[model samples]
Target chain A: TQLLEQSPQFLSIQEGENLTVYCNSSSVFSSLQWYRQEPGEGPVLLVTVVTGGEVKKLKRLTFQFGDARKDSSLHITAAQPGDTGLYLCAGGPHKTGANSKLTFGKGITLSVRP
Target chain B: EAGVAQSPRYKIIEKRQSVAFWCNPISGHATLYWYQQILGQGPKLLIQFQNNGVVDDSQLPKDRFSAERLKGVDSTLKIQPAKLEDSAVYLCASNRLRDARSEYFGPGTRLTVL
Candidate 1:
């Protein structure tokens, strides 16, 4: 019941290309978050990966977390068009809700065409 | 500083009528959330609050859905009767219940149900 699978879903680059997005899960997450929404707004937090081979960056956007924490990724260097939008990957507050309960991933819109 | 806050950015209703949505968080953020976006997916934690009460709502839809925050800051979400898949896009988020994580969202409330 704890699922969070994301992949291509949709992408359209064409300007200063470069991309990567994924988030898989079999279960096991203490933290992991990454969001970016635009049309109408809502998601914004762009990074939050806890331990597990952690790696975070924001300038060029690059985040990775997965040493066993399940999975996570997002790399978008150089992209443009304001970096398009829609890109999410959430994991937990799990172990039974409240510790941080979150479990979303079914997104990856990206467009970036200049 | 001020971020999470929602209202009637849009609504169309007709299915069965009845609708309500609102939220205001980010002042102190004692943890609060309510999501249900469904256009492209991603974002679906029906309920969660840690200051006014409920720690999780399982996934909401408590028959027809209902929510509140009492004093945990501000919140409300009702949907009795509506169903056309209940349209969707009703988000509100916050965090800081001791930094259990880090969430902050808003600017949602699309609902269309017709």
Candidate 2:
């Protein structure tokens, strides 16, 4: 089974600090997506990277898909208390049909203290 | 446009009891998904539906877990004789048929099986 592994499962930093979270896997994916989930809510999509080595930016968050398509990363610039949440990375399979599914990482919990 | 909607924000029940959760996807979305997310983990897909037809349910525990999307709009998930490990946040998500890469998720239903 394909799996996505996230690093630094827990992180704490002061506001205005920069942090990077990594997601790695042995299997390649057609696309990768990043999501941020707050307490009492489901995850909200942050960005999606389809091509290898692709990068997408949304406000203070930047997401990068690895060149091999087997890994991805999310970097937060000048983190704020509002940005504290669980960050997740999900990978979509390359193939179509019933086997086509998305695999999610365990996620990294980030706490930005003001 | 309205996002996905789920009922019963929280439910607490003893083990072996039965429980059900309901979800209403955004209007006009053809694909809907149900996911189970244990604490400290990313959401795992339990089932997927495309216009009331089951697309994938490989991960769902067929013995005690069942879900259905009757009218291709709203769906229900039921767990009979739940176990303690069944406690988790149940999330519902949906996306258009043409764009499977991006998904919109609803605030999940939190279930606690004591």
Candidate 3:
């Protein structure tokens, strides 16, 4: 079974529209991170939330960690064509090391049309 | 201030052949990671390294896959007797030993096993 589940798998929205993607898990995590990947490129870090119930904003993107630390969400305000990419959520185990492994979700593909 | 570097952005080989990909993480970063990303899926951790010592490699397919991070800076991942199912993008990422929240990634090497 996947440690993390993301939905919807694919989404297409017009520019200026708003959308939210979710990542859920049955396991609690020490931290959660969001990444955005474009075609032919590796994923780039968008934000990291370590505290439960923490919310972080990066420009037009907002990320929230669930109170129980088992889920997270990414909300985009005023999506743009440049935001078209694969959105991935990765959860770090509750281990006590900087080298703890991260488990990733299947990812959500976002297509922002101009 | 350079990001992680990966070589031979693309590779194609027949099944049962061998292939290798290389990566150089950001300078001063002591933690390195290798991930495999299949089409339509998020990247999965294959191995992680702290300095020249391996911190975690539980998910690596030992019978067919092997990786080494020499001098704790550059790393190489190899697949022997590659199979068609091994076709995917191999990504390299790294971060500071003190900061696990900001991992930087390289432009992955896309491998196609025919």
Candidate 4:
């Protein structure tokens, strides 16, 4: 079973619309990260939330870490065609060393039409 | 700075054939990772390397898969007697350090085994 679960396996919307993708897990994590991958390319880091209850914004994209550190969410405002891609969530468990392994969610494919 | 570099952006092979993929991480990055991404799913970590030493490879199929990093720099992943189920995108990623929040990824090599 996947350690992290992402909802809305696929989403297609028109430009200027808003959307939210979620990542949920039963186990608490030390940190959570979100990435975006375009077709035929590798994923690109969008944001990382290390502390629970923390929220970060990157222009049109907003990321939040759950208070319990077991979940996270990504919200896109006024979506643009450029935002079209697959979104993935990854988490790191609490560990002593820096060499921690990451668990990934299945991901959500977002297609924004212009 | 250059992002992670991968070779042979695409490869097609028949079952039981062997193939290899190469990666060169960003300069000064000490942590390298190889991920396998099947269609409609997130990328899964296959192995991780710290410099030229292995740190994690629990998910790698040792019988048919082998990887090595030489001189703490470039790395290679090989699959022998490839299986049809092994068809996926082989992604190479790098981080400045193990604890670093973001990992830079290459375009990835798409492998199709028939």
Candidate 5:
């Protein structure tokens, strides 16, 4: 089973439009992170939310950690073509050392038309 | 500072051919990871290393896959007699600390089985 599930597998929008992606999980996480990837490139870290009920803003992107610490969301305002790529949300490891593994969502692919 | 480095940005091989990918993490980083990403899917952790020790490799297919990090700074993932199902992008990522929430990733090596 997928530890984290992402909604809206694909999204296409105009350059000026806005959108939100969701990542949900059944277990608690010490921290959650969002990343973006371009074609033929690895993912780049965008933000990390460690506290439940915490919200962080990075330019046009806003990230939120759920009150229960089991979910997270990414909201992009005035999305640009540069934002077009695969957006992934990953859950932090449950244990220390070897178990410090990351579990990722299926990811949401966003395409912004120029 | 330099980012994570991966080799053979693209690889095309026939089924049953052996393949190997290399990764060099950022200097001073103690945590390293190898992930496999299939088309249209998020990355899945194949193995992890902490200072030249195996942190996690439970998801790794030991029958055909093996990875090693001798000095904790560089790693290599090898697949012997690769199968068609093994085609995907192999990503290497690292973080400054062992339990850091943020991870830096490389451009990844895209593999295709003909």
Candidate 6:
């Protein structure tokens, strides 16, 4: 079973639209991270939330870590074609030390059409 | 600063053949990771190394897979008698020791087993 589950495996929206993607898990985590990946490339980190109930904003992107620390959400306001890519959420377990391993969701593929 | 580098961005091999992928992490990074990403799924950690020593490799299939990070700078992953299911994108990522939040990744090597 996948430790992390992502909703809306695929999403296509016109430019200027707003959208949200979710990542959920039954197990609690110490930190959750969001990443974006483009075609023919590796994923790049977008944000990291360490405290529950924390919310972070990156330009047009807003990321929230659930109060329970078991879920996360990414909301894009006025999405643009450049936002087209795969969104991935990864969770770091609490038990592991500082160099903890990460568990990743299957990911959400977002296609923003111009 | 140069990003993580990977060789042979694409590889094609027949089942039962052997293949290898190489990775060179960014300078000063002490932690390295190898991940396998099947189609439509997030990258799965196969092995992790810290300064040339194996840190975590629980998910690696020892029967047909092996990896090495000699000298603690660059790493290589090898698969012997490759299977169809092993066809996937192999990604390499690295971070400063004990800093799991700043991972940088390579473009990855896409492998196809015929």
Please, what are the lDDT tens digits per residue for candidate 2 over residues A1-114? 889999999999999999999999999898999999999998999998999999999999889999999999999999999999999999887776434457899999999999
Off by over 4 Å in 4: none
Native A-B interface contacts kept, per candidate: 0.70, 0.70, 0.72, 0.83, 0.83, 0.76
Poorest stretch of ten by lDDT in candidate 5 chain A? A93-102
TM-score of each: 0.34, 0.96, 0.96, 0.97, 0.96, 0.97
Q: Is candidate 2 or candidate 6 better by lDDT?
A: 6
- lDDT per residue for candidate 5 within B7-58, as digits (tens), equals 9899999999999999999999999999999998999999989889997888
**lDDT (C-alpha, whole model) for all candidates:** 0.86, 0.92, 0.92, 0.93, 0.92, 0.93
Indicate the TM-score of model 5: 0.96
Q: What ordering of candidates by DockQ runs from best to worst?
A: 4, 5, 6, 3, 2, 1
lDDT per residue (tens digit) for residues A43-73 in model 3: 9999989999999999999999999999999
DockQ-better candidate, 1 vs 6? 6
Q: For residues A37-102, write the lDDT of model 1, one tens digit per residue.
A: 899889988888878989999988889899988998898888999989888888875464436777
> TM-score, chain B only, every model?
0.33, 0.97, 0.97, 0.99, 0.98, 0.98
Clashing pairs in 4: none
Give lDDT tens digits, candidate 6, residues A45-96.
9999999999999999999999999999999999999999999999987675
Model with the higher lDDT, candidate 1 or 6? 6
Residue-by-residue lDDT tens digits, candidate 3, B7-80: 88999999999999999999999999999999999998899898998888989999999999878889999999
Q: At residue B28, what lDDT does model 1 achieve?
A: 81
Q: Interface RMSD for every prediction, one decimal?
A: 9.1, 2.2, 1.7, 1.1, 1.3, 1.4
Candidate 1 per-residue C-alpha lDDT over B16-65 given as tens digits, one digit per residue, 9 for 90 to 100: 88999989988988889898989989988898888899877988989998
lDDT of 6 by residue, B35-111 (tens): 99998999999999989999889999999999999999999999998999999999999998655765789999999
Model 2 chain B lowest lDDT segment of ten: B95-104
lDDT of 1: 0.86
- Checking candidate 5 for backbone clashes, the offending pairs are none
Better of 3 and 6 by lDDT: 6
What CAPRI grade goes to candidate 5? medium
